[model samples]
Target: MKTPFIVLEGLEGAGKSTVLQVITQWLEQRGIDYLTVREPGGTPLAESLRELIKKDWDERVSPEAELLVMYAARVQLVNEVIKPALAQGRWVIGDRHDLSSQAYQGGGRQLSKNMLAQLSDMTLQGFKPDLTLYLDIEPAVGLARASARGALDRIEREALGFFERTRARYQELAAADPSIKTIDAEQTPEQVKAHVLAVLEAQWPS
Candidate 1:
């Protein structure tokens, strides 16, 4: 089987971790070599940038700065990690990818689409995942799950309104893009895993 880049996208506590484990198990069963990566991470410098973005700062962080830092981390990871792994015939399973930026920075921060487009074009250069699985969950329910994980990060600490907008954008993007598949994440983990496997079999069957 050809190696394809696959990404899992979701708001916080959308059970992406559980779904990811299902995928890993599926891949192992198929004897496929795969690597896992997280956006704003995967590489040393990118991990550092991730910490900067997630950490609480005394001074207000400019939205533009936040946006640029994310792109910076993305570029590093794409060049240093994802590309290399793909080149070696290893499939990549990404925790989050560019869509997070479109939803979070573009929708939540209300950044200009033109600016987002330009930055994305410059950084990604048309690179994209072959398949994207979106775990769609309501903000309220997702937040409740996230809160149980302890203190929220900077982005997670945002008001409910922010996440609402982000979820709206995620749905819009999935609806418009054929490569993105939206899963009903509010379902039980077993049900969600079954849905995920169905999508994988339909889209990337052995």
Candidate 2:
């Protein structure tokens, strides 16, 4: 049996991480084999890149630089973590993936779509999520939640308007892609968990 590769995506403060935890617990309760990992930091090399990408605020990072670094980390993660786990038939849940670049870089940074497409094609190498759960929340609500948490990262510190554009881009992508399922994330954490479980049951029955 092939492993189920699942990716969770959403704007910051969409509760994606919490939802991931709940889904992991659900799989554990069912006695299912699985692995949970986040992009840009799944492997040693990728993790190193992640630190640089998220930190070192002195230099203004260019959109192209961000795109290249992201794909570099992703390539390493795929070769080191995701591929092996799948080969062993362990379900893999990722906190984020390629769509993130499309939303953040393509939409937020206003990078060229063609350039992103080329990078994605080269790095992904035909591997895509079997199911992508996109937690949808209004940009304002999500940003408020994020700000309430405390200090923000480089990307997290982007203006609310930037996030609004990014969120809109995500919704557009979800609407166009059938494999991506949008979940309302405005609800309480437990309620969001329930919605996720229902979506998974409907999509992939056990």
Best candidate according to TM-score: 1
TM-score of each: 0.98, 0.96
lDDT of candidate 2 over 1-206, digit per residue (tens): 56788999999889988999888988988899999999778888999999988885777998799889999999888888899999998999999999999998888888888998988888887789989999999888888899899988888888878888788888889999998999999987778888899988887688
Worst 10 residues of 1 by lDDT: 1-10
- Model 2 bad stretches (over 4 Å): none
Whole-model lDDT for model 1 versus the true structure?
A: 0.94
Q: Of the candidates shown, which would achieve the greatest lDDT relative to the real structure?
A: 1
Evaluate residue 45 in candidate 1 and report its C-alpha lDDT on the 0 to 100 scale. 97
Candidate 1 C-alpha lDDT tens digits along 1-206: 65699999999999988999999999999999999999889889999999999999999999999999999999999999999999999999999999999999998999988999999999999999999999999999999999999999999999999999999999999999999999999999889999999999998778
Error of 1 at 173 (Å): 0.6
Q: In model 2, what are the clashing residue pairs, if there are any? A: none
Model 2: lDDT equals 0.88
